[model samples]
Target: MKLLKERIMRDGKCFEGGILKVDSFINHQMDPILMKSIAVEFVRRFASTDINKIITIEASGIAPAIMTGYLLELPVVFAKKKKPVTMENMLTTTVYSFTKNRNYDICVSKDFLRKGDHVLFIDDFLANGNAAKGIIDLVNQAGATLAGMGFIIEKAFQHGGEYLRNAGVRVESLAIIDSLDNCEIKIR
Candidate 1:
């Protein structure tokens, strides 16, 4: 975790709207060694649990999810941002994104999750916790067990982390950014 915090200080980019762009090594052009290290860290964090699946949102979360899923030997499922007009599911819910400033629907195939299966949610960032909530809702609809949510790097300066924690969710973040002053990382 110290390694991740140091790397974020060195390479993370702070943009407008409190978004930290980690495109240099995460979110865009990825560093495999760093990613594998993250997987190892996550494995260490959840070693005692019976995690049957890894669920994450698309784009940035894909890399970490894949690595962790491979490490855990579980199938990784990403919730699609847009549900096809023709897609069919008796169960569906909507989540509003504060970052994008819009509301969108996310769907999970009914076949992926089964009752009592533990699923660990993984994502790149936790700005407002909308994505995490969305995934939790889908898991509930399927009657599956909610294991925990894992974040690669969290901006603790924001309320996303607290929101989920307050809702009684087990949240694990590799690096917590206490501040991003003048684009420099401050770890907490």
Candidate 2:
């Protein structure tokens, strides 16, 4: 976690108030070594759980999720933000983005999940729980069990974590910030 905290302090930028941009490391251009370490830690954190598949959303979440899946030796599945017309036999879910402050849809193929499989959801941030809800919906539609939710950095000031935890979803975050102000990130 020290590595992540330090990386945030060094490279993260604040756009307005709540959004902390991590372009130098995690979100945009990823440090593969850092990502691998994070993925190893994720494996360590959820080693006991039976994780058959690693699921996440497109754009930002794909890198970490795929890395985690690689470390765990499991298959990785990502929800597509834009549904391709050529893609068939898929289950689609719509989720709102609290970061961009809009609604968008993400798609996943139906053939990925089995009724008894355990899925671990991964994402870069959990701001308002909209993305999490969409992934959870996909899990339900496939009749697969939700094993857990993993995040690299979370906005603790937001209610997303609380909402997901209250709903009986196990959420794990590597680094949680209690607050952010004047381009400064504070950890709880």
Candidate No. with top TM-score: 2
Over 4 Å off in model 1, which ranges? 85-87
lDDT of candidate 1 over 1-188, digit per residue (tens):
98788888788878765678789898889998999999889989988777899988777898999999998889998888877677676346688887777888878778776787799998888867888888888989899988898898888887789999999988999998887766566778
Give the CA lDDT, 0 to 100, for residue 19 in model 2: 79
Candidates in order, TM-scores: namely 0.92, 0.95
After aligning candidate 2 to the native by TM-score, how far in Å is the CA of 110 from where it should be?
0.6
In order, the Cα lDDT scores of the candidates are: 0.85, 0.88
Badly placed stretches (over 4 Å) of model 2 are none
Please report, as a residue range, the 10-residue window in candidate 1 with the lowest summed lDDT: 84-93
